[model samples]
Target: MTSADVTRPSPGRETPATAAWRPSRVVTVPPAVPPVTTGTLADLVLDWEREDPGAVCFSRRDATGAWRTAGVAEFAARAREVAAGLVAAGVRPGDRVGLVSRTRYEWTVVDAACWFAGAVSVPVYDTSSPEQVAWVLSDSGAVVCVVETAAHAAVLEDVRAQVPALRHSWVIDDGGLDELVAAGRGVGEDALRAARAGSGPGTTATIVYTSGSTGRPKGCVLTHGNFVDLAANAHAVMPDMLDEPGASTLLFIPLAHVLARFVEVLCLSVRIPLAFAPDSRELVADLQSFRPSFVLAVPRVFQKVHAAAGHKAASGGRVRAALFARAEATAVAYSRALDAGGPGARLRAQHAVFDRLVYGKLRATLGGRLTRAVSGGASLGEHLGHFFRGVGLTVFEGWGLTETAAPACVTRPGDLRIGTVGLPLPGTEVGLAEDGEVLVRGIGVFREYLNRPEETAAAFRDGWFRTGDLGSLDEVGNLSITGRAKEIVVTAAGKNVAPAPLEDRLRTHPLISQAVVVGDERPYVACLLTLDEQALAAWGQLHGRPGLDLATAAGDAAVQAELQRAVDSANTSVSRAESIRRFRVLGQDLSLENGCLTPSLKVRRSEVLRVFAADLEALYR
Candidate 1:
């Protein structure tokens, strides 16, 4: 069947918008899944263990580069042992346990063990500062924190006295897992089972903190039922991506993020083997070694991959660079034609030729086995989506929040729409407010924001959880996100503009790395641009300049001219009022360490504006 056939929802019922001012009606797409009444995530794991005791559950690479595999029974046993340790350490039912680490095997074991011990897991990003670490620990009242390395332990230790609730911290790199298991050896299996049994649908599973672009992070309270519903519906919608017996995923995204956490649980529920890459810098090598069937990453990862591939080809030689350019154009054309209906005869022939000559090599870089990929956390540019599809990798872009337990709406395998985030997952309802703000209501929605009842109440209008994202739904129920409600810039003339689409477009340029559009309360729209260092250096070499640094390049007339072309191209997609009339290239790129970008690589607009206030003002002057 075609993508249109897969995305078109059966018309049976309609959900009316709650607000009188809302012109867009609610879109309710019936779930493809049967009713899931799983009591807790632990129960789902146990069920899988009973059904397939010998099924390989996880594959982790050791320090020596050797791959270690674990089966369902083995992982469950280890989780129980870890749960016993938590219990032995005074982790009673309903206690809050904090996990601070990069994505790793131990993190998953500790998470499952928390559920097994009837404690709630609270994840803090590994890159968080000591102050942020203390704030999350104090706010969540997490009693025990498990850290990955001595460095992570040190960060927590610096603020340990400030957080009285954090009684103990364990470093996984220092044999913490073995020590915990040994400490709990006396604890019986029956006690662990009892802890798991105490959990129900409403029981709190995790407290994931928001990235806090604007202010302090707030804890989102997600329940066991929330995760179960999301995983079931997500798997139901994309069975081919998850349900096959040999389906596996190499998860490299931060588990602190709800999206990666959901993938972790979903893999367990469907008996799919899950693997973790220790460092994102090694993700390419890991993908080559593991050769996973599917992968999940943020848009930034895809963008980097696309850029790296282009740079590699261009650096090879003139002949190779020309072939790469022709291949990219052909791929975009072929994928766009398929989206329209199907490729014409000539387009199909051209695609087949590229499939052997160009696309196959590109696919090989991703291990030559990735059937599909999922991009979330931010919007994936439509150009990249189409290009990837042309190269034989279909990326299904999804949309959700930390509050939705990861995914509320996602594009299914064959239902790929390049721009839209596809249809809402089964059992979820999406509505657009009068002003085009997206509203979501479903079982996957979080119960509340921890210790913030007023804020929680404000988050919901009537029953629907206000997503604070602006978007619209097509007649067929596909969702297209415009921008965050709070991020929309209101020009001095009163015209509102969404910067995401423009920023996304500009980043696609070879030279542009990051773009932040600013025009709030100003006469016209302007932008702060950051150059892609590698791309710029390569461009400079191809031209005349060489050995160029970012500072020098930022002021160079030639560099400014190239940026102007990119800005003009981006402006073509929007109206004059919304277009960026001018831009200033910043000498330094925004980075996580610099506090200008979030750990997920999302630009912190407030922080950017604060840091570049003078540059922005000079543009208008």
Candidate 2:
């Protein structure tokens, strides 16, 4: 396709100008109920004693986390001991215990202890800012905190004295524990034991903080029933998800995310083993070494890895690139044909070519024995969405927030739908407010947002939590999220634009690694671009120019020409009004350290606009 022929959805497909918004058919939800009497995550943990008494339930990324021959029988002992310690240290049942740790063996231990003691485990994202972390501790009214590294411990030190409810902090010692121990007020081992030995089901399992990409974080108070219900429901929804008792996953995302916590509970519920990967360096290697059966990653990973492999293949002479390109095309065609559910001749012809070149490597990238790769946190671009499932890995797209106790909707194996975060999981009732806000309720609904009772009352009305997402559910009950209620931009011409779709399209260009559309009140739409480092370097080399530093490269006339071409290509499929008339290529990556992004990598819109005010003015100058 030429620069003017970028693949844009049809003109009338989803433009906000002509949107005929309809609420979700909330009544079309699937039916479900609790399977057993396991009142909570701890109750589920204890159940494993009857099933697999000697399987490894959890493992740290390091040698310390791996226990070759211990399962629930051992897990129960440790959790009970820890709960008893908490009690001995004065943590009462129902008190919130803040876990400011990375994904580790102790995370599960403390979480289970909270469940057993009828206390709440408040997970603090290891990457949260000091202010953010302090908010969680204060808001949740936590008494004890379980920290991971010294860095985390240090961040909490100054605030430790400020949070009146905080009495003690404990650190897991794989590497960064001393600082935590040093900062802690002090808790005896017997206290930990007493805390662990305390209660079950009907307890508040956790008060997980949501990733506050846009605003201040809210604490989602989930009960033991909320978690256990989801786990059992996940099993009922897809019984064969675990081939064996010890299925594994490499945990890289911050454990504070509902997705990560859900996977942890899955490990306890199904007797699967989860290996932690707290550091970025260990992520890929751990994936290969652990050979995990399942992988859950954001779209960023899928895009970057696929792009890198393509670059590598391109470097191997023209013949290799063309071969791989043709194979990909063939594979997509074959996959689509078969996906349409037919024994068609065209499908057979296409698959024959696809298998010889792409399937093997594709399978290897997914850890070889992969069953499915689950994606969430953001809406994945359409092309990448289809590309993953098209490559033979059963990619399941899901939708949820911390308030939902993990996921509310998921695309399971036999019920797969490529572009959408599929049907609502059993018991989640999805509805639409007058303003296109998606509201959800049911067993998965959180009890409340910590401390902010007024905010909590506003979010929940007549038993529904306004999701703040703008989306519509289709005939089959699958949701298609267009944008956020707050995130949508309104042009001066009164055109409502969902920036995610346009941003997704623009970022697909290798040269433009990240972008944010800006037309909220402007006459025409525009965007700010963050250049891809590798792609910029490659472009420099290809054009016979010495690669400059990021700022110099972004300002380079030649580099600007390349990005302009990319912008032109990105605009081809959209309407003139929606097209970006101009843009400024950013010199530096948007990051949290510099106050451009949140800890979770979401752009701080006001901060970015503030920092780049001159450049933004230059767009129209």
Candidate 3:
């Protein structure tokens, strides 16, 4: 059964947040996914492995300077054996299995086994506090928990006494799986039969938690129908992207996030290899090893790569730097001119010049095989987006939340808009509320937040899921996300402003890093910024302000003023009411572990409210 079989469309509604952006004429929806084959996702893995051996499905870097991987067929067989081990340990169908770990080889093995053994996967962020972990363990009613490292083991053990449902806790990579799986030796009758019995498309597959940028994280339960169809729909949009039989997707982003997990399943189902990046530090080498055709990453990765290229270009004399700058912008403009539908001989000549001089160098750093990059997780700086596209990289921005199964609208590969987040996926319905919030509905949409029926009911009126994001659709069907409804800051003068646009402007300044605007119920916009460590390092050398580290640089009067200048200059582009009048430089950088950022690297507003309560009060002082 598909999601269509599980829920019916809501009745016609009168009032709604989004008025529904009706196309001038109805466009055909994308194809609904093919029916899911029986026997679960594990079956897909086994089938691929049997076909190819050197084909590595999952690989990672070890701390001792080497890469690791499991064979295409070996990977599946291990998961089968792992499932047998779990069943012997008392795991049963409909059981909730918590994967409490960072992305690693063992994490994949255990997670895959959970699904094949007829268990529900509960993926939690690795940085979660002990108390938060306990809450998830109890809330999800998990029967088995897979701990990543010794650190995770300690955390889970602290709460195991309180969580009675947690019967079997396996510490992956702790030197135990080999012996345990051997003891189970071959598939047990009960678990093997149970695994073969299988589940329908509508059965619960996983419960993914949102990054909780708005408040405490809420769990969104997605079934086989919600996710399997999304994977198949993704294939339909760019059918040729994953055509190579031995293709691999380098898994770096945290699997706890819905986007990464969904991509993992899609790759497996489509018969592509999955090479897990060894660790965060070894990502570059991992990328080179796999030579991925497509990569899904956040904007931060592109920003860092872009910054590195700029530094390389600046190494030459003043004349060389100026020439490179002129060449780069000309290339960007030339490319844009072509994308506008018509092209000229003069534009082609300019493009050829930059392609030889600058774009070639940048492409080498990216390993040269990357065809398209899909950026999501948060709003990308518009200027940064333009910079990447200009450098000859086609970056497609997609829109969705954990609640929508991670995607509602994605810009098509052939047709892309630099500033907008592409068109709605085929087979999905996207419209704007009368008030302008994005509303989405279709087979790809999730059933509801796990157990919050009231919130679910409130979220839907006439079948549309309220996105809480504000934006308008262009004539060609691209989505432009302008701001969030809840984050609108009002000044003492009663003028309202959306921080995202202003924040984007501020980020364009080379010295400024993360800009978190604080003006809600206040007189004007104020911000807390994390200075770009690399840029600040360069600035110190140029200005003779010596500081070896970021913290020391933060206190250097000259460095502090340089950061202030970037902020002040960005403020100049906005109206007086929306501009930041006063700000403070933070000595300590905002971090995920410190409760300053979400797992996706977005600033946590409530945490900012608490940690910087004194700094915020001083703005009004």
Candidate 4:
């Protein structure tokens, strides 16, 4: 209910220009959310248990790859037992419980049980380093931590001595869940119910940490009402995609990310059967086996799918490669035509031909039942979005931040926009500050950054949360994100450039895995490019340069020429001032372990620059 003062500036302003950027006209979507009166996530789960006790609520792959399902009643029973266990273990109301695990059945059980026990759940990415784990556990003041494996537990153990608040660590692989349940066997059902009843809209449900691409991670305090409102609004907006009978999604993105977390909660609240894949490597197999109706993934997943299809087709020989190329062209053209209005007879006929030969095969890789997907965490390239839509799988791109508790704006199925992130979610207001920074005010927005009141105050201007993302709204309200406001580079010539569009386009090149455009105060725009190891090897083989590694390929004139073509194509979309004039191909790839990329896969520009300072300096020289 509190609003930050909009008329004044706050601390931690990244740039002086933040105060100088002109605010764009206010853009607000028509309110379409029905009144959300859901009390809490635990309340929703209990409601489903009573309403449809026999309906399937969750499914996970067994050791032999068979899906094991749990019904609403069964799920509720297990969660209550876990809640009782937490109570027996001395976890009290409002206590913080850390969940350090992959996306799996136990993670869900513990998450739901946390709510049932009136405790706050804080998730640490399964891939996080010990220092990150320690930071989150300590910062959130978590008393107990649940980890997926002994290795995960070890990471926490290494940091346990540093985190004074953490008192217990349980490893799921070592019969941790069973132990908790057994410990609670003596606790009464009334006590579990009392714990569940203690939670309400005002209580913090979770503190989701940001991916920390720019700095140390900050925990965003999202309340029960935040999740309730987000789920209700999202369901109301995309009922056909999310609320249909037997609707399910194969969740593979780390649940530590807010986007994935929102989808998990949304599926539960809407009574949609939820399936879990251990990781991205197993995702394709799981999708093929589960045949989910829709999927929600980061843009990288889609890019990989697209790249794999291209590689597979090209490897089939010249005749097949030519046919695949034609099909892809037809798909892109047909999709563009449809977005312009609707496909014409000729375009429709072309699409029909490809649907049988190329599109159908690609869909089968996703298990043949997928009709829609949601891409977020970063920009789903405009061309890729159209290509997928053309191939019978419509990807509705949405945009949000960890602070927004998931989606603030999403493209609706009916009003699909190829390049835009669609309209703001119903009940969410979207506006632009003078500097073109996106501003959002909605029920889904988080209350604060846990224990970082000054940072929290600085994040909000008036009642709207400063998204710090530069974007625009179309005439009908479709939102197109341009770039990160803080990431804009001003060259020595005083020309401003947004790196995301260029970087996104560069990554579309099969040979390039990651691209970071630099030249903030330099003479011209340049980039540091990292090769995709698989793509590099494949390209090398195709070009009769077999056995060439990434390091060798980076210096190969032929490979450089091929990459230059991609850079040229990307440059065509922008003015000369913003064009990438030169680039350095780095032999090594940016990764989370190296601290060059965030857990969500965003490049850490500063880290990348620091590590490759000499290589980057060589470019301008």
- Which structure among the candidates has the greatest TM-score? 1
Tens digit of per-residue lDDT, candidate 1, span 493-595: 9999999999999998878889999999999999999988887777777667877769789788998898899899999999999999999988899999779
Residue ranges of candidate 1 with Cα displaced over 4 Å: 1-23
Candidate 2, poorest ten consecutive residues by summed lDDT: 6-15
- Candidate 4, residue 494: Cα displacement in angstroms equals 1.5
User: Which segments of candidate 4 are over 4 A away from where they belong?
Assistant: 1-23, 34-38
lDDT of 4: 0.85
lDDT top scorer: 1
lDDT string, candidate 4, 256-321, tens digits:
889888988998878799898887787788999999999988898998898888777756655666
CA lDDT scores, all candidates in order: 0.86, 0.70, 0.72, 0.85
Native-to-model Cα distance after best TM-score fit, residue 597 in candidate 2, in Å: 3.6
Q: Once superposed on the true structure, which residue ranges of model 3 sit more than 4 Å away at CA?
A: 1-28, 32-39, 46-55, 62-69, 186-190, 196-198, 244-246, 311-331, 341-357, 548-576
Clashes of each: 0, 21, 15, 7
Ranking by TM-score: 1, 4, 3, 2
What is model 3's C-alpha RMSD?
A: 4.4
lDDT of 3 by residue, 539-576 (tens): 55555554535778656777667667877777777787
